[model samples]
Target: MVWAIRGATTVSNNDADEILTETQNLLKEMAQKNGLAEDDIISIIFTVTKDLDAAFPAIAARNIGWTSTALMCMNEIDVPGSLKKCIRIMMHVNSDKDKKDIKHVYLNGAKVLRPDLT
Candidate 1:
């Protein structure tokens, strides 16, 4: 079955290094939590708030050896009062795990986006 895993994390600033580091961390956590292998991943879509335009979150995945993965990045809707410097990811994967057993990850200031999941 195909399952989707969600994750989000915040960067301290709009620096490329900061964005890359935080996104890499979030991806690692999501993979670890879901017991996901690169071959299991179908695609990854990343969205970043307007404040975080320093880099593309997909680059972080590539830096971590996800060269062949289908990855894309876009700007998140600029909602009023929404969290800033946040990078969010939705990863689709082929997994046999039950839906209820899937784990979603939210880190740093992005935890507020899904308090119950966090």
Candidate 2:
């Protein structure tokens, strides 16, 4: 079976190190919580708010040795009241777990994006 896991986190500022670190942390948490292995990952799509342009969140995946995994990054739509400096990820992976058992991660300021999950 295949499933999609969602996660999001915010950087303190538009700094490359901060973006990379926070994104890496979020990705690690998502994988850890879901018991995901790199071989099972299909693809990962990362979206950052317009305010976060210091670096591409995909680099964080690469830094963690996800060299062969499909990864992409883009900017989120500039909605008037949306969160700023936020990075969101949608990861598709092969999993045997039931949908309801999947764990979605929300960290930092992005926790507000999903009150129930946080």
Candidate 3:
């Protein structure tokens, strides 16, 4: 089976330190929650709100031992009233487990993305 683990988080600020820490924590949480294996991960896609253009969240993953994982970073569409300074990630993984077993993580201010889940 294949599963997609979706997660969202927000940086404390535009500073590199904040982005790195928040992004790393988010990815780690997602990986842990879903029991993601490094070899099982097909790819990871990340997007940040327009208000945050300073750094790429994927770099945080690489810094935290995701070097072999396929990762991409993008900008979220400019939608009115959307959450600000939010970084979202969608990770695809190949697994033999049932899809319902996977847990998606939504944290910090980005919980607004999926209110019922967080």
List TM-scores for all candidates, in order.
0.98, 0.98, 0.94
lDDT of 3 at 65: 84
The lDDT of each candidate is 0.94, 0.95, 0.87
Evaluated at residue 20, the lDDT of candidate 2 is 98
lDDT by residue for model 1 (54-92), tens: 888899999999988999999999999989889999999
Candidate 1 vs candidate 3: which has greater TM-score? 1
lDDT of 2 by residue, 1-118 (tens): 9999999999888999999999999999999999988998999999999988889999999999999999999989999999988999999999999999999999999999999998
Report the C-alpha displacement of residue 7, candidate 3, in angstroms: 0.3
Model 3 clash number: 0
Task: Supply candidate 2's per-residue lDDT for 35.
Answer: 96
Please give the TM-score that candidate 3 achieves against the real structure: 0.94
Model 1 / residue 87 / CA error / Å: 0.3
Off by over 4 Å in 2: none
